[model samples]
Target chain A: MRNSKMASHLSHFTHKTSFFTSNPRRPSPPCMSVVLSTAPTQSYWASIDAQIDAYLNKSIPIRSPESVFEPMHHLTFAAPRTTAASLCVAACEPAIHLMHAAAYTHEHLPLTDRPRPRPGIQHKYNPNIELLTGDGIIPFGLELLARSLDPARSNPDKILRVIVEITRATGSQGMVDGQYQELGLDQLGSEYDVIEYVCKKKEGELHACGAACGAILGGGAEEEIESLRRFGLYAGMVQGIQGKNKAGFMEEKIEKFKELALKELESLQGKKTELISSLVEPSLAAVQIS
Target chain B: MRNSKMASHLSHFTHKTSFFTSNPRRPSPPCMSVVLSTAPTQSYWASIDAQIDAYLNKSIPIRSPESVFEPMHHLTFAAPRTTAASLCVAACEPAIHLMHAAAYTHEHLPLTDRPRPRPGIQHKYNPNIELLTGDGIIPFGLELLARSLDPARSNPDKILRVIVEITRATGSQGMVDGQYQELGLDQLGSEYDVIEYVCKKKEGELHACGAACGAILGGGAEEEIESLRRFGLYAGMVQGIQGKNKAGFMEEKIEKFKELALKELESLQGKKTELISSLVEPSLAAVQIS
Candidate 1:
């Protein structure tokens, strides 16, 4: 099934849903006749339904506001309660250190900066320079979030820091702490995927445990919902920024900004007046001429 | 990578690692040279240390409770009022339905009658069975958790009825929502694996929203955890009963049950020597054995 999929994708474009010529003499696959004649629409629809079904059924509560992260909440609490107490007296810090390192280096990994590994990480997106701090002094991005959320702190400056931290974690330069994600996914896949998928779980956790923790973490469900949209936007933006597809990139954020602008304009009487002015001005000019 | 892997698995153990090996005359994969030239144990340790160093210095948290989701809690409650009550009337039922479907289906996916698709859902574990309800009234296996928690009436018979429902979710004639599992490292070759990577997301209306919803459906965090574990275990057991590896079947749920059981055991111990043999035994066994 896997082997045939790639060829089928190509053939689908050429044959308009038929993979092989219907002629008996054609050098097609043994079962190609059956597949071409009967399977195209069914398989196509099946695949679409599979993905949709996965989304509708299997994906976890990513954007939900209330009780969204409850499953993850159990997992997070499962985080060795002794983690805080055992921090100093442990050589197991190597594993913990590895987790932190991976968290800082990889994307969607869970690690804090209090246990910084070394001084710096990598260079990417010359657009901004972000480095890794081995220890978690920044501690679970607390320091970073603080830098951003604090009124006294500078937005662009702190965002710049977050930018660097984020880049480090996302790109190859960062380490990914997947064990936690494994805990979240019930240890479903490769350690690598654990952290990658942790993105989904972390999103769940924040929504589950709200308190000063929630206040600090912002596990509010609506915000999580926004995050769902935000992630799609962020990924698109990152891809575009990577110069993967300039058109896709430009339209992505631009369209989002345009939407916000339009919404704002609709809400404001002044903006409405300005828009109507342009439309009504020609009539006014004609009336003056008359 | 995938080709080599699938070939190796489908073939035999003798050809396993060498599946990726190059012809002696052809350029050998880097791994082959290491296979022949064993490194000094000290240097192996050194290299591991270096890798650890490199890995640690680069880690960051992106998706843990500490990273993505929890930080947004403060912002959720600012606009506490739902302005349009009429909107609630029109939207609430569907929203609840979506939640119920998502939560119930997600919960149901782990039942014995696993593939609860109806209206295109396996719905209940049995082949051709359709998924139609929200309250988890389906399957005898999952009904155990439901009836265990249903506040309307918690009679033993009701609980037993619920268990009976849950049993319907499991077994050969039930849901069989499909599955996913990772092989252990020693037992692994090349990349890690999904011993049987069933896609639950493609199964039914159960998204992760159900994982957390299990807590509510089961009536609390503690019970919800049990509900999830019981469901995962029962589904896995069904898969095994269907003739997959018995050990593999228990693998996913063992840790899950252990974790929950241990926590329960801990709380059960409380501050006293109240080692209520029934509750304390599990915890004591876990403490001693684990």
Candidate 2:
């Protein structure tokens, strides 16, 4: 049933870059289709989700310690698909999503005396299990990336670079620092500079890391990697800023960031540029529609 | 003043393996001395602690978002020295301690409703900051290890292998799983089998990872790595079981584990073998003295 659904999507994108087409190591199913720039966002997401599901199933075998693995599996599957995952090459999509899920798990941890009801996975498990599961997901993500290293096809240096990129983006100076700052936001007051700094570190850095890793893994040159890293950073800033405010200043800031994100792709020529642009366009559309 | 203290300790161990001597890449202090097997544990710990303090000071710079980095630094420096840190090669010792500090932070997180006062760094920070600090520390540990990787001196594959070893030992099926099982221990009832399983996964696996990583980084052969891994496992099991109970059965179990741990080292010969045995002897002595 899943294969037939994937087949249907494949048939629609014969001229475009499909996940299976991007990764030649995996045998493409008999009825494979390519993805085009014109493909609906839902269909693109469907392809990514199917691949993520397949990857998770193969990589994380459900075994003993059902208590831990089960929740981790649920959170990974349930995590909302984001531009960060979509911006990656197919090989890195699952690992990117694993990171997203791990961060999401910690972000929603019940640190307060009266915990708010978190959407999706948190409702299913108690707080303690959730905390431990978040801890497990991160190492699991690193292991996935490490396991994916192929010296025959990829450079070990690049893999190490990707690991460093991801770790730095998520480490003390990045996402966690952002979260820590957010906790003190009430005391610091919500000045625009403070908000931007926190958003850039928390949301923008992870997105930047994702794009950078994808570029490194896909064998892009240094300039292309930097461009995509900036693109991800600008696009992520737009995403981070969207719900934080509804004022004119925030709107103008979003438009500027969106333009910057697209400008980063202007120098590059390929199907990937269009695919990457599509990731940002939806957020802009969401803003305009709202 | 610190240098004088280090000099005094260096004078006591002129013939044994010292941390600085193990890694020729690092320049030794002017009055450096080699460590011998007879060097007191306190002197070893002081040397290790001094190195840890220096490493943390160098690696984690105090910068913006002092709220996060400060607590992370505090937790890392304040964490008790363990045999795992001693078992590593000098170059990898700081990274090993970072992993320990990261795990220790999470292990002592205020998960229960009635929070107990934790011994060290926890006393300084609120629960929220402590939680975020733990989140930050893990990625910092990974970054530290990745940054330590130099293709000139270390094989990227070996470094990747060590990363996998540490992540697996600390991931869902390892330390986190053990913590989750401990949470459910009330429901499951603590049979010896259950306790052993938890201890092996939680404590033993981490020690095994430390020994295996040290061996890999130190260029040990496969047989030697396996032997050290088993040695760490048995030794860690004794450490885990030591405080759980004082019953005769528990003592018998500790003795058996200690013997097995010593037996694993019998095939190996060198200063390292003596160094490795010293890691376990202190625990045994504590048990006997009590």
Candidate 3:
């Protein structure tokens, strides 16, 4: 469950990563590698979440055949991997993650070749890495993700520019940023149950904002604007189904999702002619540029 | 945390995944992954596992997301991605692993602009992958690791082979094999916690056999044979660490591991003396080979 949870999150990452990996649009290792360490625990299973979160801010354990005793020495390291490389790295992210956990957790037997000595703590262990640990994990992997994806300010501007311009055509306020914010407060089950409530509130604001923006983007064409409104209603209905696991949907989660979807389609079809009329008719112009 | 965990386990699948993603070299993932889907409660988690296993064998939730939603339809088959030239593909062992997981888990938005409908399942309802059933897991990842890494067959075949060469390096009398067997049982924790025990028995046999084989590989020289014995002992001590995790460091376990390491060193030193003797005694009938 905990581990699979990682897979679920990572699977999305792989898709986003594949686009960049095969495209050759960014640096070779686009991933933002973040490594952290923590103290050992009595129950390896229970501490899994803390272990995982440590990838960006603390330490984690890598259980291995030799890990329990005569454990391999901690080999965790943080590095500035390029976004292009990170994406390419994302394709193989699962593998890197395993070694990352291993490199951090194994702590008794240092490889004969390595010369570093830090007892009980996993350090930046890889030779081919340039790592930095800040005051904390405030920025972590997210910092890398943001920087790597920014086209206008890309370090190697052209490569990152292409990555965004090509696959991430969601434009400014679509799924990319929206998704990141959702992940933040969505850790509802652990210590941050409050995050779920906050997320729901934020989501509501986003919906309202989305409706206004869509209408504006459509130039206030009444019918088209209405269609956008219908879509929002429809989305809310669909979302109700998703909210069941949380606290959103009470009775008809699935049914509501269906009803909303159908209603939106019907509403859109009904307003087809009006939308066309709006598309053709123009409001009076205040001044002529010519 | 969840995504990292999944990536961690999946990485253990190795079997030709990008070096950045997986490594059987770190076996923690499989165990961690299972831990995620199952629960500490034991009963509930077990049932969840069964459900997932069933899903693994056959499709469920009759209406799935793939055939129904095809959420990314516009991006997948629309304007920019229309032509085949725009797509890229890869081939590797984990390539199949990836394909299998996708085949089982992927629910539709669009594969090729076709109507694959799921009655209700929205694969991307959450930003993460859904656990169709609580307990289900993909087994191929482990197989991939084994096929790719045949310990019996590495660059220097001696160290490459898993149990075979290692056993042979130990001795023909099976003494070395027994030692490895003890350690194999003590591998990392998992639902299949005791598999290590079985592996340990085999490893013991392998070591004894491996040492004997190693001796043959060495020329018929007393010094070389002694060195091979020492190597086997060192390897055995390293392996014994695995066993300690289970039975723990009982006095016997501590004594055995320590004694074995010392014995290995003793053999190495003996080899050094034999090499010197060979130089002094011209016709010393190369009595031992490592």
Model 1 C-alpha lDDT per residue in residues B1-290, reported as the tens digit of each score: 12233222223212212212334454321111121113433342234234322321222112333322121111111112211110111101112222222223433222222222234333222110111111111111121122122122223322222222222222111222221112121232322122322222111112122222322222234543344334333333322323335445545544543344335434423211111111212333222210
lDDT of each: 0.24, 0.66, 0.27
DockQ per model, Cα = 0.01, 0.47, 0.01
Evaluate residue B29 in candidate 1 and report its C-alpha lDDT on the 0 to 100 scale.
19
lDDT of 2 at B106: 69
Put the candidates in DockQ order, highest first.
2, 1, 3
TM-score of chain A of each: 0.20, 0.78, 0.24
- Comparing 1 with 3 on lDDT, the higher-scoring candidate is 3
Model 2 stretches astray by more than 4 angstroms = A1-42, A112-122, A185-189, A245-249, A269-272, A283-290, B1-42, B112-122, B185-191, B245-249, B270-272, B282-290
lDDT of 2 by residue, B167-187 (tens): 888888788887877766234
Query: TM-scores of all models?
Result: 0.19, 0.82, 0.18
lDDT tens per residue, model 2, A1-290:
13233333333333344322456554332211222334455565567567657767756666666777788887777667666665664445566677777777777766543355555634566667777888888877877666555333445667677788888888777888777777663345657766777778877887888777767765667887898899899878888887576435687778888899899988665524554565667643222100
Which DockQ value does candidate 3 get?
Answer: 0.01
Q: Which run of 10 residues does model 1 chain A get worst, by summed lDDT?
A: A125-134
Ranking according to lDDT, highest score first: 2, 3, 1
